[model samples]
Target: DAAKEAIYARLKKSEAGAGAMHFPLDRDAQYFEQLTAERIRTRYVKGFPQRFWWKPDGRRNEALDCRVYAYAALHGLLSMGLNLNKRVEALPPVPASRQSRNDPRPVTAPMTASPRRRRMAISSNYI
Candidate 1:
């Protein structure tokens, strides 16, 4: 939620910068809220630059989401690549060899794939 708020601030500033690129206000508040939300998500989940639909010109723009850009510019370089399964991944593989006085063995388990039903659950809940 905090990041989302920050995204809102970024979007607001961006909207001002965009001038004519902002999403149309005619749709209603709910639509704006929805658009704001997606913008925030795109920042972290997909890297940077959120999407917006401008009503004045009825065009979609991929304006640079400065908030995300700043975040990624600072943090992305340091992070190891994220594994896709890690999002809901259970754990790492267990050790297959070696032993220790304390019965040394890897305890982490690999992630389980989401069942089809559960897989679809995300888009519905979050979107």
Candidate 2:
């Protein structure tokens, strides 16, 4: 009965959604234990749904995460336990090219050659 009341109170205080709390990754049950106790004592909540961020490139196998996941991985507190199917490509650095000259071009007559026939060299955006 008391637990039920506490749960209700915690839900009421969760106006900021599930982002309000985080559980550090660890095998030790103490992490879960203290999480529950703190929420119950202060907010009276426990166990919100997990959240994830889609990778910028939208790579299925390379589903990178930010915020909480980044924090956890950086601290060696968590590891991706699943077998992911993806490749990690090393992105090249973007060169600091000078801006195009602002000089205006004078109007000229079209050449006898076909204008549609032109060459194009595509480049990737490396940073």
Candidate 3:
């Protein structure tokens, strides 16, 4: 029950833009035992959900339902004892030249794009 509340508090704060919402990527149950308000808030900010910013209206602006999937995936990773930070670090970085200067794509656009079109280019995978 306490764990749920902590996560909820972080969610509320993140929605209100009160602070950063990054959570630790570790799944060790013991890790959560050491969480303080400030620490959990930091973890939430760094978690997958933070990558998809909420709109000013406190709604997800992304069309991909990232909040749902990101959280789901986070928990899944946690259950498997996987380190999100490691997975992220292992992935290749995106080049600055890949981003378009004239027409910036919406944050949700990538997931909403047709799978076939998305595979057309490596940059489009996350564009």
Candidate topping TM-score = 3
Q: Write the per-residue lDDT of candidate 1 for residues 11-99, one digit (tens) a residue.
A: 55643563223443356655554444343223333676764423334433223344446556545644766554554355544355533
Clashes in model 1: which pairs?
A: 24-55
Which candidate model has the greater TM-score, 1 or 3? 3
Once superposed on the true structure, which residue ranges of model 3 sit more than 4 Å away at CA? Answer: 1-4, 14-73, 98-127
Using TM-score, rank the candidates from best to worst. 3, 1, 2
Better of 1 and 2 by lDDT: 1
Error of 2 at 74 (Å): 22
Estimate every model's Cα lDDT from 0 to 1. 0.47, 0.34, 0.47
Q: What TM-score quantifies how close candidate 1 is to the native fold?
A: 0.20
After the best TM-score superposition of candidate 3, give how far the Cα of residue 58 lies from its true spot, in angstroms: 20
Candidate 2, 1-127: lDDT as tens digits: 2333333355346455642433234436543332233222222236655333223242232111223344455345325442222211232332334233442333233333343442221122331
Evaluate model 3: give its TM-score: 0.30
How are the candidates ranked when ordered by lDDT, highest leading?
Answer: 1, 3, 2
